[model samples]
Target chain A: MTALQLDTKPNWFMANWQQLAGFGLPVLAIAIYIGDDIVEGGARLFLQRLFDGLDNGAIYAVVAVALVLIFKATTLINFAQGELAMFGSFLAYVGAVTLGLDDVKVGPIPLGLLLSIVVAMVISAAIGAGIERVLIRPFDPSDHLPVVLITLGLFLILNSLAAFVWNVNPREFPSLFPARNESGAQNFVEIAGARLFYDVIGTYIVLAAIGLALYFILQRTKIGLAFRAVSSNTESARLVGVRVGRVLGFGWALASAFGTLGGALVAPKLFLKPDMMALLLIFSFAAATVGGLDSLIGAIVGGLSIGLIQSVLVGYLGDNDSAFIILSLAVAFVVILGVLWTKPAGLFGTSAVERV
Target chain B: MKAGSDLAASPEALWSEVEAAADAGWPQWVRTLNRTVLVAAGLLLLILPFLVESIALRRNASLLVLSLGVLGLVVATGKAGLISLGHGAFVGLGAFAMGAFVDLVGLPYPLALTASFVTCCLFGWLLGLIALRVKGIYLALITMGLAVVFPSVAKRFPSITGGTSGRPIENTLDAPAWTGLTDSQTIAVRYYFCLVVCIAVFALTRNLLRGRIGRAMQAVRDGETAAAAFGVSIVRLKAGAFGYSAGLAGTAGALQVVLFPFVSHEQFNVFLSFRLYAAAVLGGIGAIIGAIYGVIAIVIVPTLNDIAGGLIRNDGRGLLDNDVIVFGVGLILLTFVSPDGFAGLVQRVGRRFSNRP
Candidate 1:
């Protein structure tokens, strides 16, 4: 019996082949790229690419989750989600740069940064909820085209509004996690000969904290339960005494806040323009689809993989140029089409059943 | 005695005559009225250039081109219930394809126009075939993704596409000397060229929509399973819808260069697609008149600004400042007030007046 067990293949591998394939493929691609350079000159470049992937992935994940939030609540993809978040980032610009909050400080924190963050979040939450109440609630929710069109209309309105306000010129959004003035404090920590900046580390930590807060609020709170109940089944939740309409409003508000924060995080890197989140929105849409539209964790996985895949493709297959960006998008478009054709439910989403 | 007399009147033949009158014959009065109105409209259109300023006539020609473009969207998004937010690219493809046919392949205007329409239609069919698996929200995203790649691809092929700076087309369409029109009235001749194309294309579209293919599209739009049950090829219908729409858009684009004399990358960007989608919505997706009205909505805005320019600003860009607001808000209001669009409103008013009898 012991001999039979030892000779036999592991059951775990047999049971989790799909998951293993999922993780294995990426690892194999990386290994193939960095073959025989585990400790050589390739290590630093690899590490740097990996870090960049994570940074890009983190931003994509947030935006993807923002999309997932609205999808969860209404089963409608918000085309305007990016624009709404861009609006929030604009609010941040207004609070910090326009309002002179960046110049002042409250103790250790810069007053402008703090004020922008808090105000932008609060106002964004309100705007998101108000939009659901006023604009979305009025439309027939079951028809997908009308809702999508509505969001698209909002996209135009919000985008042009931002441009009208800011004059279409690019503005530098001051980084929230500004590097310390001292050169010694700003020193990069070398990891496997790759230099990691403090901003990247700080950003990762901040994202984690935000994610943690979201997870708890969604998984552990009373309002979270109401939100989930409505998302799962609005009419059924209403039968159970939950205010379905209010939950939807709250759901939208939360989604907008999340998207706003995501846009804010990316604002500095994107240089704050009306079209700042436009390309990122496409990537996030792809990420959301690949991860499974209904799954939160799927969004994160999708983002990270997209980021990694894109960085790797650019590094190996193409150079950093407009043409290369087009190539990357084309590849992403293919991936989306493939996933849609084969597995419409995505990797983690529950398969939707349509009744005739 | 009366019954016997009626029986003598070829009873079977009488019933057949009744059926023919009921279904086939449009009432003579209504037909005559329609012809009269059409004649009047045509006469007015023919003489419109003579009455209006050169700029206004040129704009009218541009409007006609836009109408052709939006007509394609009406078939796809309007008739088939397929939400396409990327038709702007089709317009570009049509324009560029026409340019290529004329300049590179050395074809004349008529052949180039047909080639452009066919090329764009074929593309639409190909993309429609790929999108068979997806439905609803995902379908929209798939189409949007397709739109996103258009500009980049256009930019990549700078040689044929003329890159960022758009290429100028040869002035092949000109007034015949037999018309007694001078060089000063050449713009009127341009208007006539557009009229001929528009009439031919619209007639073709009407014929197609009333036939078996149109019936298939309507069936698919309403209920897919039922249509499939009837042995209708769903893929064919879907592909046909997209292809037809794109074909019309390309035809319009070909004419667009005729009117403007230049085709550029900026003219076919993603935002233009949004504007087209918005135009379809405002025009009433399924109505022919909606396309005309919808194109007019966008075309007339700047004209309105020019009219209101003195009141608002000295620089002549005041109305543009509120363009986004107007378009965005206009779309929302359309959804609320008349989801069927301006054509729907016209139909309602017409009904209300007709009902007074």
Candidate 2:
């Protein structure tokens, strides 16, 4: 490791110089290109792109939260976060669709979907705990290489295990949120002459609720304090009588639950499959990277920003065979590189001082 | 125990015995033994396609070629501790270079391969320069992003790379007309071509590692500040490793065109990098000879999956169902149980047989 340098937090505006341009340059370029297209394509297409971007952004943020959870705890990127979530979604799928849990009802409301989600989340939590205990705890967690390798191994295992269990085919998942309102019409609320989807609205509400719940758990709760202590200094926290092992397990569990929930929500729209979240995982990495790796709030904002840029840029690129497919990801990667080059610590990351 | 005691008694006795046994000189005899083994292996490989009688089995060319790419990875990640998760980009760069030089520039096969090597070396050097600015996990992330970017980068240049479809080399070098080889034999010629390249690169890497640059790389990997204090230009040495590794990868990629006949945008996905990583880890990374073991594991993995799948099920599923999962399990288990990997395992075996400490 390079010699660690200490730094007082600089003003956001001061730190923003490189990153602002890193993000803004691409935004400006995309905007100019989109502005050119809007003159010909008009408002409806633009609105659709915005809505799509928001929807994608919301999902990316949700997953990025999961990423931030682990990063906070271990400072290591879990390559299998998506796979683990995909596994959780697969579990939910099994409980709801394969086993017909959705057939059950609690009075007028069907509790089956809710039941499946609860069951899957619990199982996913356990899976996460097991993974940390079995695969991670033994290794030197400070070294990212081993942990990354382990997570990659987990990625492969979970991905192929899902394939083995579910078969390598896409399965339809019921949406947690309804697309239509009570009136049987596609739910839309008009804002600035642009219609918003109820599904999209419901997604936002669910994500916001999750966000609030996370905020409460991280801020207000006792376990959250324990988690923070453990994350900051595992040995010192242990010395101070914190149950570091259990706290680490809890963090992993929470992260996995978030991942599973993110997957369940996304699977409905993208269709449930082992590889469905693979590419999204890459985008989520970008989001996590774009945001400071350690900051939860930064992750959310980064996710939303990346999601918007991706959708808008892709939309602007148009469907020229696989051009959008390749270019969108290429552009995202470039953003990551640009950020790394300009601001190694990231936008919201604690900039460690470099003492020569 | 008695034999061991005899060895403990005198180094002179053993040395004298070895000296007496040598027909030429001690060094010449060892060289002779090495040459003999090489010649025998080469002959066996040359005749393999004829004996196998299956073009599908001959697809081990891909394995050999991929192993060469993994060797490049070892140079960066293992020897230099650079942690490049994006070696596929180097491989892809090389593959595309081969296509451009051979098809576009109309170069001969050898010259085209050299051009591909030189191209990947340049890119690797640039990435290494970036490595100087960033260290540790950050570098890994950057490389990972590069791995993801590579396919699209290749696809963007439709004229050069044939978009997603990829370009195939025309007028491939074939077996001599004198040999009167069959179709499979012609394919086997490609396999031999890969094997020769693999051997050359392996020897080259071995020699580099045995020399001054290799020590400097290891020093840089161990401690950058200390290396700089010792007057080693961290940038030059590190970038040189990157260049060399990428050159190896490029060489592999060039060979891949000969073996596979085409290169696609999809061919050099991030998964390729991961697989190379897995191979390196499994084969005991940083050691050049372990590359063969790594590639062997890679090639044999599918077969193991097939055997398992065949015994377990004969339904509508593919023969190698969830093979990747098995590899995943192998990776996890191998890391936990035998972190040193197959090279360490081999050393243990050799030690056990020889009864050496």
Candidate 3:
């Protein structure tokens, strides 16, 4: 019976692989057809798309991680996360322009980028802490929906305020990396008959560094332990001498800071506009769900997976505009279906047992 | 449940007090004069087409479609307790069906409308099944996901949906010879048709609220478990309510297509769904009368903003920029101060004055 069961499991796995292969073959064929000109060009295109996906995924990861932190500590989704990030970007713009740091002669690129990031993070953290103290503190956490509504209300208020302050025009944001070629001229270094994009390399390095730093903090810090404790059981954490309120506030602040960094990083790629993050926010929500809303690692994995899927689908398939919308719905449908099919908890979610 | 008892008692006492204080208030003759004035206003509206130019009539005809959309919301969110952020999808479904039938399939406009209504009803039924399993934020999120996903799906079948741009519908309405109306008079005729539809819908909605189904919905909204224990099929009721709401929205979309000359994907974006919620809330969520008031406010706000901007000789851009801020602030203030909305507040104030004795 044991041998039979084992055999069945392997058969099931093989069947799943076969089904995936059936779907993937068409995509592979399309890619090969498009990339037939240059072998290295095909590889370069793949690498570029992958790196771009990682960068985009990293933004989602930061937002999702922020959401998870707040959810863990306070059991709230913080619907205003996107708006907070938007506000942060606006502030970054102000810091660059108002502070006269936009001058090209202001030292080198690294110093200016560091200064702007610091300013953005500080402003973002303050906004996060303020919202937590003023808007969220009065609401009872157990009554979840009303709190969600309040966050939505705040979202509207912040979005409108951002629009009111920064007129609705999409502004050009300065890139963190210097775009000038290393040889003091427009240079394209051909490697294996394909050019290596510098932006892709920079993005990969930054995302990797951020991911490593986050992993270390969660795994090896005292604050991280308290955060986990509060998330697991707030009442127990309080009993065990953890300042639950402070932890939640800290989580919000951290989320805001991460969101600000994401906005800053992505601003150069996309135009910095008040409503720019609206669709991104929806995409992030899909990623968060796919990763399991409460799981940090799941969020990172989910974000990367979604980004990859979105890029590849758009690159090889027809009409890239609908890719995000289609992918988001597909992910949501799968997540919901998976919940019904195997475990209602989710792919990586802890099964929530209600006592009452 | 507590609210029901309050409603039953307060109105009776307020009416009697008004009766007693009538002498001290406005004279009986003056009161009769006021009623006459109100009646005259109604008569004036009925005969407006005879007096006003066709251009104003044409413009105001669009308001009827908006009113119908708000009325649909009154059923879905107000009565049925289903907060659908994607009601526009149903509206789009209805509009697209109407367009396809009347223009492409060579069906009569009225029959096309019926087809639209049926299509929306079916879609609503499907959505309601999902709604039955979720409540509160999850329901809201799911409906939002539907809205976010709908435009892409609509664009997928370019031949049917006309792709991103959209297809135009030829004029289906012709002025009959007996009416003594020209092409210019068609606008007034359509306006009356819309007004009649609105009145009929309002009457039906009011009657529905007073009936057993509305009571069951209210009971479900108040407490699902208790309603279930009382032998109410919560799932069926929810589905019925959603279907009914979708039918109303579809009817509105059909009217919109008829009034306008074209139908497109841009007409049914996610913002439209948000605006529907705003109109419902601004009007008064739970009341039929509130829906009418809400639709008027929603229409008038933007128009008034534009007018004000024009008056000052400022470009309309600033006014447009401030629109979101005003809407956001107004929504927050309305929810905070009068959770029952403007209609409820007006009703309460009217009662307070009537209870002077």
Candidate 4:
């Protein structure tokens, strides 16, 4: 009896064998290639790549969530999301660098960078809500053409406007976390011979905080209930006495604020530039598509997976060059195509139902 | 009754007889005057290249090339309701492929042009297959991705695309030796070459869009499910429209190579795609002649910019001074004011005038 019990497979595994195989096959393939790196350069190099991938993945996740939020409520992909994020980052630049707030202190806390980022996010949120109200609300939602044109036009306007304001030059953005200690030592913690920077930790913490804030706002608040109601069914929500327009504005505001956070996190690494978010937008789009356009959890998973694939797969296959970046983009494009072909609704999204 | 039957047998005669009956509405003099103006305009176009400066001639040729590009977008987005934001990629592919065929494979100019069109058509078909799986805005997203990724991909292939620096074709599209044309005369010859191709493509497009396929496409655009119920294959109609549209853009790119003899990856960025879409919207995407007007409207931006620059006594490179900004403003304004674009406005005015009489 004891031998039989020990030999028997788990029930969950038995029930989900097909799903396990489907997921495991790709994971095995990825592991095989990564295993090659582990053998050649030891676990240190593997850890380094993993750490870097996760760091970038955090930023991708934020942007993907922003995209998903808008898609959930409106069924419209904001083509200008990345541009708005880039503009928000510039506002941070204006707050911190231009206004000389980078070194300022408030009470016992070093709150300058935090204040600037928060201010930028708030302003971006307001702008986003205003856009939904003025530019987007006037158009018929069923007809997608005008809205698409408007968003795309906004994309162009915001991009060139930033370029005109900042000139096409790249500027160094102050990091939220200190890069060096008082003793002139690098600020990082060594874990298994891989140094994890404070910025990466800070990014993750802020991401968690934002996630919690969003969760509470969505699950515990009246407005959040209205937002969820509208996102699920606009007509039903309207029938139930919800102010659908204001709820949608709130949704846009949240999406924009999240995008600003993503921009602020990535700015230190990517540098603040007019078009910094362009390629990142493509990656985020792939992430959103792969995870399911309307699913928050899917966005997070998709974003991380894309970041890992780009960093690990492309990193192993190609060297750090322009060619490497192009290869990563190609991989993302292929991923988008593959996902759309196989599962249009994505892993987490509900499949669309068309009534004939 | 016999005279009425005879008049009905000849439709033009019947139309004229009806026009005589309704004499206050549309006069015979007005019809003749319209025909005269059209003929004079055609004659002016034929002679204007020789009369204008070489720069102006080249500009006109490029404008024709741009019209082809806009027409390509009009075909897909206007007719089929497939919004493609990455047609610039198709144009780029055509330009690069044209250069490759002519320079590397040593193909003749006409053959190279044909090859470029086929190549771009194939690519468009392939992408359409993937993109058209799930409907509505996914195609736009994918095509925009294509536009964004094209430059990087083109840059990766150094031999064919000349890497980052770009490729300069050997300029083999000169006037034929049999023409015995002088250098200045050759400019007019090039202009005429572009003009002829433009007219040919437009006529062909007009013919194609009036056929069964065009009706099927319109049916699909109007209601996909109803069209499918009516036995129209949505996939084939859509993908074919995409391929044909791409072919037009490729031909335009081939023409651009002919006009300028250069192909660069950077020239085919997202901005070009945006400008093309903006022009399509501003000029009226639904009408074929709208494409020509769209290109002409975009071409006038620089001249306006120069005038604005002179008035301000500053370099024409300040905020809101760029052509792209104007295009953005135009796209938004057009969407709000005239969703059907300038062609719709013209049609409305025409209708109003015709009704007044």
Who wins the DockQ comparison? 4
Best by lDDT: 4
State the lDDT of candidate 4 residue by residue for A142-227, as single tens digits.
77788889988999899988887787889999888765343776778899999788877888787788778878998999998998
lDDT tens per residue, model 1, A1-356? 68778655687667657656655675698677756554454767878877877778788888888898888888999989999999999998899999888888767556678678778988999999999999899877788866876788898889877876676788988777655344657446789888777666766776687678778988999999988888888889999999878888888888888888888888878789988887788888888988988888888888888888776555555555776677777766776776777667788888889876
What does candidate 2's lDDT look like per residue over A87-180, in tens digits? Answer: 9999999899999988787774458987898899999999999989888988887777778778878987777667766777788897766544
Full candidate order by lDDT, most accurate first:
4, 2, 1, 3
TM-score of chain B of each: 0.82, 0.83, 0.83, 0.85
Q: Which stretches of candidate 3 lie over 4 Å from their true place?
A: A1-49, A97-100, A104-108, A142-149, A178-196, A208-230, A234-247, A319-345, A354-356, B1-56, B303-316, B319-322, B344-357
Q: Please give the lDDT score for candidate 2.
A: 0.77
Q: Each candidate's lDDT (Cα)?
A: 0.77, 0.77, 0.69, 0.82
Instruction: Rate residue A42 of model 2 by lDDT.
Output: 74
Per-residue lDDT of candidate 1, residues B1-357 (tens digit): 123233445534433433343233234443454456456756877788878898888877777677877888888877677788778889889988888887788787788888999999999888788776688788788877767767777876776678878778764566777988776577777677888898888788878876666666765776677556657788888888888898998888888876766777778877778878888788777655567668768776666756764554323334345565566777888887888887666555555555233
Q: How many clashing pairs per prediction, in order? A: 2, 0, 1, 0
DockQ of each: 0.41, 0.42, 0.24, 0.49
**Candidate 4 chain A lowest-lDDT run of ten:** A177-186
Clashing residue pairs in candidate 2, if any? none
Candidate 1, residue B17: Cα displacement in angstroms equals 21
Candidate 3 local lDDT, residue A40: 49
- Candidate 4 stretches with Cα past 4 Å from truth are A1-35, A106-110, A180-184, B1-45, B177-185, B310-316
The TM-score that candidate 4 achieves is: 0.89
By lDDT, is 3 or 4 better?
4
